[model samples]
Structures are given as structure tokens and as C-alpha cells.
Target: MQRNRSKRYRAAAQQVDRAKAYSLPEAVSTLKKFPPTKFDQTVTVSFRLGVDPKQSDQMVRGTCPLPHGSGKQVRVLVFAEGESAQAAREAGAEF
Candidate 1:
């Protein structure tokens, strides 16, 4: 049973590869046939900071890039004050 399943999976993968090579347009159109139901989906992501505090003057902060660009919009929040906040605003940050 396991061997049969493996054979079927390999055959399917090969068919996909052949389709990608021969009928690239059909393959892409078929993929785009399925429309996502939800447009705005919020996902939480985390990252680890491995910077040495003694060696580095500036500490690493904030969230990193998400896989597949999060498939959502991003809103940047800045808590800087005075000149720093003005600089951030000039740099095109929302807040």
C-alpha cells in the first residue's frame, strides 16, 4: 500500500513538472482559478535577537519580515519623540 501511494505521489509530481514546462500559461491560470476568500488576514510573527549587548550600541528591535510577505498590509508605529519622531515622519512612517 505504501509503495503504491509513493508511486502515485511521484507520478503526480512529474505531471505537475511537465505541465509547468509545456503548458506554463495553463499551469499559472489553473493556479489563479482559486480565489482567496478572506483578503485581510492578520498573522502574528516572532523573531529572535542574537546581538551582543556589550558589543552593539544599537539594540535590535521590532518584528521581522513574514513568510510570503504576510499576505496583508502593514502599519508602522513609531514611539520616538522630538527630532527622532520628526525624522521618522519625514521618512514616511505612519506614526
Candidate 2:
């Protein structure tokens, strides 16, 4: 199925050649060419490996260092009542 992309995404996509694999420096320079955004943006890089994950020898592994840390929202679920509940709320847990 064809997916609709925004004008900003379309313009950025056009800068890279999909048919060719870009080197580290090539990728960095291409991204540097883009205009800066008003707010902080996160960059996610994913590698496509040809190895089979089922095989013990070929374990899918890699870590992308997010300098700004993971944009993960953490939620706490407390199953307590009375004083315990009050303490949890004080510790930043949403009731």
C-alpha cells in the first residue's frame, strides 16, 4: 500500500538515493544540509541485517547511543491504598 508523506518528509527523502547504500560520512553530511528545526529532534538509525535471528550464531544486536536519551514515557501503576497510595503520589506517580 502507498503511504502519504508530508511535504517536509518528501523534501528530505529526495536528498538521499534509495537505490544506493550511504556511508557514515555521506549520511552525516546529507543530514547537516537540512534546515534546523524550532525544537529538538531525535535521530533514529536502524540497520537491516541479512542474518537469521533464529540461529544462535546470528543474534540480532546493536545499540544506538541517544545523546538526548530515549524519548520513552514511563508510567507507574500502584496497587495500594491509604498511606501507601499517598506516598506513591508524592514520589511523582500519577493517581
Candidate 3:
């Protein structure tokens, strides 16, 4: 389903030449020209994977740590058993 864009959005989009591929610096410069909005605009991306949902083997799930922190607080949990658990407690870990 296609939805029509607002006149403001269309007008802003028209100012740029679609055929031209912008370098990183050029793209950043172009974006800086846009008028500031009342609230910060959030950008998101979505991908459709070619996988059968019914097949367990086709399911995908995992975590990828960022080289730089993601600007969000994270909670880490480690399971320590037997001697390892005692060592962790002695190391001042919260129970």
C-alpha cells in the first residue's frame, strides 16, 4: 500500500537531483540544510528475509556486540557455578 507524502516532504525532496549519487560529506551537508522540526525525527530500517517460518532450521536469532557502545545502558548477567560461582562472589559481584 502506497501512501502520499505531505507537501512539505515532497517539496524538500524535489530540491535534490535523484540521479546524482552523493558522497558521505555531500549527503551530510545536504541534510544539514533541512529546517529543524519540533521533535527529533527517528529513522528505522526493515528487512524481509527469505526464510520459511515453519522450519526451525531457517530461524535466525543472535546478538552482535558493537565495537563502540550503542549509547544505551546494558545489563549483563553471568552464570557462575561451583568454584567459579564462589570466585565471582569473592570478586564482589552482587548476588
Model 2 is weakest, by summed lDDT over 10 consecutive residues, at: 38-47
Q: Give each model a TM-score.
A: 0.31, 0.49, 0.45
Q: Which scores greater on lDDT, model 1 or model 2?
A: 2
| Reference-based lDDT, each prediction | 0.61, 0.84, 0.73
Per-residue lDDT of 93 in model 2: 89
Clashing pairs for predicted structure model 2, backbone only:
none
Pairs of colliding residues, candidate 1: none
For every candidate in turn, the CA RMSD to the true structure comes to: 12.9, 6.0, 7.4
Q: Is candidate 1 or candidate 3 better by lDDT?
A: 3
Looking at model 2, residue 22 earns an lDDT score of 80
Question: Per-residue CA lDDT of candidate 3, range 1-95, in tens?
Answer: 98999776777687678898667677778777766667878534335678887899998788998787788865445588999888877776666
What TM-score does candidate 1 reach?
0.31
Candidates sorted by lDDT, best first: 2, 3, 1
Q: Which lDDT tens digits does candidate 2 get at residues 27-84?
A: 8899898767677886877667798999999997779887777878788888889999
